[model samples]
Target: MRSWLLKSLYVLAALRYPRIRPDLRYFVRDNYFARLNQLRFWRADFLTKTPYKVVEFYGEFDQEIRYAMPFAYWHFLNGTLKQTVASKNTRPFYFFSPDHVEKYEKRVWEAGYGNYSIPNMTHAPTYDFSKWARVPFKSHYQNDVFVYDKPLLVIANKYNIEWDKPPINFLDIPALDRLISGLKSRYQIVYNRPLGGQIVHDNSEIMDLGEHAWLRTTHPEVLLMNDLFDQHAATVQNFNHLQLLVYANCNHFISMHGGTAALASCFGGTNILLSHPGGGFEHEFNEYNNLFPNLSGATILHAKSREEVFTLVEGRF
Candidate 1:
């Protein structure tokens, strides 16, 4: 967008949503322009001129789930999605009916709205899903082999580089200990921190938290995702598929920020996300209360601090 036009849009956004922070107001501007841009395709979609509309994206996993995936799902529901494209290991995510996702690209997601071409996709996910259909991940992936004695609680943690810096919005050993110690008896706890190369890398470098050995020694009862992967290696297609199976059966999750939380929120449950670095847009736009829930009616509780994680775990979880 031109600088002057961008300024004018920002002004319009501020006038529209005067109470929100400046960041979100600009997001509103971006979304409005993005919607305007989508008008170009109306003729094709309305006329059914194309046999199918192919939507392709290889962006950051978080943004993909937050914006792109849902946008594509809307097209699929409306009988227009012919094929979807993304980076490797995302077949499980797009495994809705007539699932056709070709994962052959490598594109690091920019912080900017690089996926504006996706119909209904914006920097911040919209609250309404009237045009969206929740992907039935649980129905497709749920299995009796993954059943547990008690209700499942998936603890999806990640220690990855954030914003060219060291790990942020991750659960350290102490926080893990507290979560396990507190919720051990009530639910079947599953600990997950996908090692480097296990999934697609999107600019963020996966750093070792060195908590796996500690979890084994300190809390042997908790099921480690790595261990589960090995145990069910013969049965599951890949790590992402394993997650879909396990998380499909789970109703409670304690996930770190970004993609980890995004995946967990796909299932209808309560996900307590640990985002220590100010909660980002998830807080700024109240996505936790609105957009996140739109995924599968999951209650996304954003904990801006580790202390608040415990508080939310005790009270909400």
Candidate 2:
């Protein structure tokens, strides 16, 4: 009955935001519903704060970065966060908190990736992290280990499965060539495209772009993330750790959409996110504009096409 009522009310909200797909109407409404639950616990936060105030997530990396991390960090700031639970190799992200429990849920990854993990994070009005505490990943990881003589520029690329289609919003080799040729002289480029096993697997499969060898041969000056992970095998925990450390130093990024762009935004820089799809949750709620930037007050330039990418690169980067 409650689901039926929200579904009926969602029709009105959908008309106002018609870009959202029909199937996601309830998901968005449920987020707003869960958000309303916050008021019921507002008074409890100060007096009832306890070690039980934990946040667990095994969702899409993008949503995890946008919603789950900040939600947990907010609990940390409020002194209520006790133990964070998530998949493996994520301690680096939650190191600032009191405790983190790494428990990989490969089976549940299929259903994860929304504001459903915790109730407070269900708010629909905002994704702003300004009032919230920003996880000090950059300050904690930024060190002299990965310093470069030139200003570092990270091009975090992704070539994999996406709901929108093959050209879901990743840069092909030719476009990469254009960016590298244009920016390599001014910046020390670190090209990142994590292999499948390196990052926790999800529904999305990592399709081979076959660009690793091309980057080494075509632009030997450019750094590859896989090689860096190999070179600093003992120094960091995993590929995610290396990315945080390296990305912490740079202030400019050209990345594919989804988690790649979200991670880049967390470190505070100008992130050119290639997002062309029209009907994903990103477009549905239209919240990423605020959510991504507030992650660290980063400047985000959304380029809907490959041509616009270079245009923003020329003007912003």
lDDT of 2 by residue, 148-222 (tens): 989999999888878735647788899999999999999999999999778786777779899999989999999
The per-residue C-alpha lDDT of model 1 at residue 52 equals 73
Off by over 4 Å in 1: 1-7, 19-24, 47-50, 97-107, 125-131, 277-279
Clashes of each: 0, 0
Candidate 2's C-alpha runs over 4 A off are 1-24, 105-110, 113-132
Residue 185 of model 2 has an lDDT of: 97
**Candidate 2 TM-score to native:** 0.90
TM-scores of the candidates are: 0.90, 0.90
lDDT of 2 at 253: 94
Q: Deviation in angstroms for 162 in model 2?
A: 0.7
TM-score of 1: 0.90
In model 1, how large is the Cα lDDT of residue 255? 87
